[model samples]
Target: MSLAQPAPTPSRWLRAALPAMFILLGVIYATWASRLPAIRDLRVLDAATLGTILLGGGLGAVLSFPLAAWLLAHYGARRAALYAGLGLLFGLPLLGVLPNWWLLFAGVFVLGAASSCFDVAINAIGAEQEREAGRSIMSMLHAWFCVGTFSGALVGSAAAGLGLSPLWHFLLVAFVLLLMLICAYRILPCDAPDPDAGKKHFALPHGALIWLGLIAFLGAISEGSLTDWISLYLTDHLHASEAGAPLGYAAFAGAMLVARLVGDRLKDRFGARRLVAGSSLLAAVGLGVAIAAPSFGVAVIGFVLTGLGVAAVFPCLFSAAGREGPTALAGVATLGYSGSLMGPPLMGYAIHGYGYVFGMALLAVVSVFVAVAAMRARLLV
Candidate 1:
């Protein structure tokens, strides 16, 4: 099980296909966020109610992780991934068409559950692939997610510009995702988890894993806060034009994508602990710079810095989770995902009560906590 062992290299097509699937997932998921206004108008739900309903998706995702692990163990990673992708194809289009808040909520919940299951299974498979390849590949895998988000945002903007309905936009994207999933089906591994892995049950997170979960939670909070509110912050606090406001998030995402693309080399040279620690500190500095800047241009620089700082943390955390034990990796990943789930709503509440600048400042403080925790965990490779 040592990662040092020489293993067969994956084909170029497989490497390319894997990231493409992740990108497709990101594009499909992000389409909903970009069209939030349309969905709200269609469903006639207020902000508060909408937030509450969105929590159902998080709940469903959390609940599904254990089952996902069991399925991966029994049915194998390929089947689990295929089922999850099919679920996305089935569930994503409903968001565009659902006319009622209740139906939209239910659809989102199922989508979340299926997506979470897919996430764990795919990560496990990807980690295995990386181990076999004898190189660090996780960061690039996540980079594709950022790439997908970027693509989705661009598509959303195009649709908005054209005055296209959300349903039509999503339908097109869903068809594309369906086709991509079909194409990637063959390269996905059918390997099952080891049989003697023991009884699987949902249990509360404990030990170093709990600490790792907290680190992930704090890191996610920083990331989620920026992604969810950076645009609003630019508009409300910096007085940037609506068109310019999204630049904050765009800069962040672009920087993150760049960092992730090169992160494996960085990790190989510096180790995960150093990288995580440096990233947290850089993120904190970025937040501070953005908050204190006098102009939107400077704030954009800050956003880019924050993105660079945050880019590699997720892959490092996921790799650590996998190394903790194959049997426990799903539960750990679930905990991490749970942290990510909490970040958006909490940041929303913070923004509502304290204003966007203060909320981001709070996130900067949390980023410091992530640095300290990463140092304490000492889980770097």
Candidate 2:
């Protein structure tokens, strides 16, 4: 049905279901993120302490990757997704109800593992669908994820404003997400592995997958930095009210939402090679703008630009990894995702030591690597 894809074929059910899974995953993540300020205030943690806690998440993700790949190999993407999705749901409530920071850290760590494993499952399914769909569908799929985040963020802000507890908010989100998962399960591939699929095993990154993984790593650092920091930055630096703190984050996700909606077309027009290079520089400029901005309002523009700039990178990189091979995809995804999960803690340490301005500027400095990688990465795919 698509103009550019080469494929033996993929199921219509899979093509239809994977995008919803992407959205559901985003909702799961954003809901927790939306309520972060509440948790911060409740826990009374400083930047350094919070960074330490967030590091648990990165560790969890690292632990989960091999397990996730094994699950995918033995049970297939569908079962892996459901298993991790449930794990994530179980942890969301713990984040709100934890008695202290140490327990919270443990809970977050578990959630982080669930998050990455879920991501791997859906992305593997997405890659399969993209190959079947021909042209570029990855961006559009991720766009749904953005949309879910945007909705969750807005809901979180409203919930905070309405005097709802984080515990209650998380429960409500979990219920909705659970329902979505129930629907998704009916349409996804069964637990049995596909013998003909040729990707039953996992391997370390090799050849082009290495370059693609590097590209994924670089871009993810920028993305993770923004997603984890923007809301807090709006509050601490700009003195925005708690209810309004999420606006900046919303702007960031909204820009990504719009960009990815259009990303497939852009990819078609420009190709991943040239497009990613320009996008990296654009993100750098955007970060610079946010860092130099005189007001919260102006900084939001920068966030929007930053979001728009990096929106296409994941879709392109992941799609290319899929093209390389399934084992390569798993390897590249783990490393690339490692970069994203690590960004928050790294930036947390930065902001703790220096200041918010310096922390943001650090992101700009990091983008330089992304720009260089983007240019060089074209040939690898």
Candidate 3:
């Protein structure tokens, strides 16, 4: 490694800080999401009004991703992450204090924008650092994200169960996250401008890059659909106990977490494309069982299979995106994130019209398509 070769092998500080950033982002976003019902009740808003308010975040995410690409190209991933991290720090407290409709709208929008910026920047950093290190660490980094989500959601869920104030709960979580961000900023490696960054600011992903994006889209929507619909399907369609309905999703998430933690080794053995295509089929089969069996035991098994199946997908796809160029990766990630955000509602509408079984079946169909696509694509990895 030369003196100018991007800090050979990634410093220990960077390895630690990158995952910490992921944890912080996950905790912040999950904590906020878990408290939405409380926020709705406090504001005395109907479902429609609340839905509109939540849409602010989605709108903000879509609008800012292109800007995130520009920032990554011009300022580099580290600075991009730092700037976006500030958005998270400031936005967390604002979410707690919004008292009026307009303020609520603005608050969510800001928080959404901040989260999206951080999402883009941090993933860019993860991909950058992984390339510099010459191996597969994206899954490990993403596992920390899952860990943070679980930790934060558990804490928030416990707090809510205890009837804690949402405002106070949010503020405390924000304070802790703020501290984490400061430490990460202090120790992580700095960034330099991309010499290759020319007059071009953004490039819509084409060729193999578009295939990667499509795969990301499918994987994300499948994951999102499972999270949103699992509980409802379990209780409504499968007749699981109220307390037990959540176990289906718990199974799914837990399996995915475990798979991601071990995914790097599996990728080393099987290769990413094989892992992706094979897992997509596994996920499809699991979802097929959920559609066919319609029993509690089978449902749990299905969820587990689905989770394990797609666990390595996002990290794998993102790794391929990195090879395609940062701008192209940005486009790919934006599309994937958008699918995650939109997939739940779309699945919900389908469930409403036909049935929960129909929705799961739809995802099963999509998973098969992803498998076919994954088989065809020429991935960089």
Candidate 4:
């Protein structure tokens, strides 16, 4: 093959291995997220402190953008993914075994950094595959991520109910993820270094990308806040049982999984802008309902709606970014992921001062911003 020819996409292995990797990614994140209440109880941390610790993870994610770019440039997507994945598998157990919340903050920071880096690598490969096949598949791949989180949340609920220690639970999940990672390492497409990666290490979103980033920013705040706080809200505010607390996130992830499974079709039918605008509005409504819920069951129904509402936002936005090329995609993704991962810790302070009600309400308001931003986004199609 001529050097001018782009890398050949993988065979059927891409279909099988890539989605499994996304699922594993989701599982790893949800394993820790679903168990936040237990960790809080173990560390005897208040909301403020827990939020501070969670901030470390968000900081790590934001800071990893350059590192991710550097790695993808030097090593290629597969090894970048492998390295980050190993970092996560190694770091997660530390969250469970840490001596205190202070130490836990350090571990979570590393976790976030690795998680975001892995995400960038995986999406980079997925975009390449989609471009090569001349089709749409980003949504489907992200659907698998939703599947992983849903499954992880359910398993976490069971573990918490069984009175399993966080250390043991993390270890078991990490082992399973390791097996999945091994398989993925062998089958995933071998995209070479991004040709322009060196020059674009610190690229920032601009023009249309800024609008797309805005949508991602608000969408992520809603998504991340719920992932990090919804269960705790169930437990502390609604007085849910240990087993039942995680059900809130399970509902969210499950609903998102179902929606994302069909997200490509929906995006094709309605168009990206319409789908995002409508979905953001739906998320706002659903989150409002959840916040106002009088009982745990009622709150779960709201979370389900919220899940359905936000499901299409990321996939639609990311796919749009892909059309703009990898550099733009990376820039928008960095901005978005930073918000999604980092915004939650910031919300902790608000929740600490005013309460969970305020925190949830703030997210509901932000969902409106997502809708408005999507409506205005010129790059969405």
Q: How does candidate 3 score on lDDT?
A: 0.76
Best by TM-score: 4
Report the C-alpha displacement of residue 55, candidate 3, in angstroms.
Answer: 4.2
- Once fitted onto the true fold, the runs of candidate 4 whose alpha carbons sit more than 4 angstroms away are 1-12
Q: Sort the candidates on lDDT, descending order.
A: 4, 2, 3, 1
List, residue by residue over 154-174, the lDDT tens digit for candidate 2.
988899999899999999989
Residue-level lDDT tens digits of model 1 in 1-381: 322222344777666767877887678655765666556556776545565656656677778888788777776666777788889787887788877777776887887788878877778777787787888889888899889876776676567557778888888988988888866766554475557445663454577777667777688767755664666577668886544554456667778889999998999999988899899999999999998999999999988999999988888877877776555677767766655655665766666667767777898998889998888775556
Give TM-scores for every candidate, taking all chains together and pairing residue i with residue i. Answer: 0.87, 0.93, 0.83, 0.95
| Cα displacement (Å) at residue 7, model 2 | 25
Query: Which is superior by lDDT, 1 or 4?
Result: 4
- lDDT minimum window of 10 residues, candidate 1: 1-10
Selected candidate, larger TM-score, 2 vs 3: 2
- What tens digits encode model 3's per-residue C-alpha lDDT throughout 1-381? 332223433567656888999899768756675565566558876544554565566667778888888888788887777788888877877777788767887787787677777888888888888889899998998888777766765676667667777788888898888888877866667687666666665666687788887887778778755654576577668886534555566567677778889999988998888998999999999888888874899888988898889788888888888766778778887777666655665675676678777888889998988888887778735
lDDT of each: 0.74, 0.82, 0.76, 0.86
User: Candidate 2: deviation at residue 296, Å?
Assistant: 1.6
Residue pairs whose backbone atoms clash in candidate 3: none
User: By the TM-score metric, which is better: model 1 or model 3?
Assistant: 1
Return the number of clashes found in candidate 4: 0
> Against the hidden true structure, what lDDT does model 2 obtain?
0.82
lDDT of candidate 4 over 1-381, digit per residue (tens) = 432222445667656888988998899868988899999998899999998999888889889988887888777778888899999999998899897887888998999999988988888888877788786788899999999999999999999999999999999999989988977777665667877765766577898789998888788878888888888999999999978999889999999999898988888898889998898889888888888899999999999999999999888888888788767777777888888888778788998999988898899889888888898999897
State the number of backbone clashes in model 2. 1
